[model samples]
Target chain A: EAGVVQSPRYKIIEKKQPVAFWCNPISGHNTLYWYLQNLGQGPELLIRYENEEAVDDSQLPKDRFSAERLKGVDSTLKIQPAELGDSAVYLCASSLQGQETQYFGPGTRLLVL
Target chain B: GIQVEQSPPDLILQEGANSTLRCNFSDSVNNLQWFHQNPWGQLINLFYIPSGTKQNGRLSATTVATERYSLLYISSSQTTDSGVYFCAVDEYGNKLVFGAGTILRVKS
Candidate 1:
């Protein structure tokens, strides 16, 4: 079976520039999540969505980071005016509705100069 | 909020040897998963043992949710096993709280 898929596996932008990452989850999966991982660290949850509704986004930085799963099958995570600290891997994962083992995609590595 | 702690922040083992990695959580969890982040930066799901024991090839995992701990055992390790291993838990939703991973390097 095809796992979660993410685009632009690597991105580099100047500080204060906006960047976006896209993800397409495995077929039939209903839960999607975005996570941020610094070097040598485990991923930290940024937001989680159940279908079209964002159920948990407390960890997301609203001022700069915004995410949407408009169609419920695919998701997009955006960072506006990204800072140097935002230079990290943006990971996308998916699972069955409610709760299930998540399958992750090859993350997009963002580098802000 | 939940706290997850992994033991032996770093481990080094020779090929064909055995090793154990542990995870301890601060509170009750509804689900638990083990992941291996390979050199290419892909998070590979190793096991989803919220409780009980499971084995796959040279690897096995046991989760004692009541005791708030889980263990991953690698038997006859190989150099390809090098990477970081992470433990994540969720109490309310699939959103996980992750622990700092344990870095393992298996040498030939």
Candidate 2:
């Protein structure tokens, strides 16, 4: 079976520009998550979706970050007016309903200058 | 919110050496996992052992839920095992709290 897939494995943008990352979870997985990982640190959850409904997004920076999981399969996370601190890896993961083992994608590395 | 801490932030070993990584959590949890972030930046799930012990190939992990700690054992390590190992736990079974991670380098 195919694992989770993400688009634009790498991206570079100037500060204040808008950027977006897309993700497609594994087949039949009903739970999806978006995480941000900085240099020398573990990933931190930004948002989580349960079949199109965002159940946990408290860690997301609503001031400039927004995410959507339409139809409950694919998800897109966007950052408006990107900042230097936003330069990091954006990872997408998915798991079966109520299952804790999450399968991750290759991830999108964004570099904001 | 729960806190996760990993000890020996960095470790270097020869290809044939063995090592143990530890992870400690502040609160009780029912969901715990170990992940390896490769040099190419892929997060690979190594184990989903919230309790008990599990072994796969040269790697084994044991989680003692009662003590709020987990151990990852890498025996006869290979150069390919160089990367950062992360331990994450979820108290509510949804959102995971991750440790700072342990960086390991296996020399050839």
Candidate 3:
């Protein structure tokens, strides 16, 4: 089976511009997560979705970051007025449930200047 | 939030050598997983071992939940193993916290 898929493997934008990343989890997976990974660091959870419901998103920057999972399937993460500090790898992962092993995508590498 | 720490931060090994990576968590966790992030930036799930031990090919992992730590062992290491290894834990089974990762370089 194909693994989780993410769009625009790389993205480059100027500071103050808007950027968006998309993710499609593995088939039959019910849980999806969005994580931000900085250079020399591991991924940090930004938002988690159980089907179409966002169960945990406290780590997400509400002012500039927003995410949505449509119809319990594909998801999109957006950063409005992107800042240089927002430059990082945005990874998407999926699991059968909360406790299952998560499979990750190739990730979208964002470079904000 | 639980804090995960991985050590020794960086390692360099010769091909066919053996090495062990350690991960420590600050609190109790219901799930723990080891992932290998390749040079191209793909995160590959290595093991979903929350406790006990498991082996696959030339790799193995042991997690002692009571001790709040896990160990990943790679034997007969190949150059393909070069990359960053990360350990992630979920205390409530809903959110995952990841360690900074151990950067490994295998020389042929």
Candidate 4:
């Protein structure tokens, strides 16, 4: 089976510009997650979706960051007026509902100048 | 929130050598996973061992849930094994808390 897929593997934008990343989960997977990874650090959860409902988004920056999984199979994470500090890798992962194992996609590398 | 710690922040080994990486958690967890992040930043699942041991080719992992620790072993390491190894734990089942990760560089 194909693994999770993400679009625009790399993105570059100027500070204060709007940017968006997309993710497509594996077939039959009901849980999807978005994470941010800084250089020399492990990934931190930004948002999590179970089907079409966002079960966890406490770590997400509500002021400038927003995410949605409209049809439940695909998700989009957006950053409005991106800041210089927003430069990092945005990763998407998926797994079966109630299952512990998660598979990750090749992440979108964002560079804000 | 739970704490996860990985030892030997970095390691360098010649090809054909063996090494082990360790991860210690602060509390009991329902799930534990090991991942290898390649140079291109793709996270490849290595193991989903919450307890007991599992092996796949030259790699193996063991998780002792009761002890709150896990170990990943790389046998006869290859240059392809060069990457960052991360250990993540889930206390509530969905949210994963990850360690800083161990950077491995295998020389050919």
Q: What's the DockQ of model 4?
A: 0.92
lDDT score, candidate 3, position A28:
92
Which clashing pairs does model 1 show? none
lDDT of 2 at A26: 97
DockQ of each: 0.87, 0.91, 0.90, 0.92
Query: How high a TM-score does candidate 1 get?
Result: 0.97
Q: Rank the candidates by TM-score, best first.
A: 2, 4, 3, 1
Q: Which ten residues in a row have the lowest lDDT in candidate 1 chain A?
A: A94-103
Better of 2 and 3 by DockQ: 2
B7-35: candidate 2 lDDT, tens digit per residue: 88999999999999999999999899999
Alpha carbon lDDT at A11, candidate 3: 94
Error of 1 at B1 (Å): 1.6
Interface RMSD value for candidate 2, one decimal? 0.6
Q: Residue A113, candidate 1: how far off, in angstroms? A: 0.7
TM-scores, all candidates, are 0.97, 0.98, 0.98, 0.98
As for candidate 1, its interface RMSD to one decimal place is 0.7
lDDT by residue for model 3 (A1-113), tens: 99999999999999999999999999999899999999999999999999999999989999999999999999999999899999999999999973568889999999999
Provide the lDDT at A34 for model 4: 99
> Which prediction has more favorable lDDT, 2 or 3?
2
Query: In model 1, which regions exceed 4 Å deviation?
Result: none
Report lDDT (Cα) of residue B20, candidate 3. 99
Clashing pairs in 2: none
> Which digits, one per residue and each the tens of the lDDT, describe model 1 over residues B13-83?
99999999999999999889999999999999999999999999999999999999999999999999999
RMSD of each: 0.9, 0.7, 0.9, 0.8
CAPRI grade, predicted model 1? high
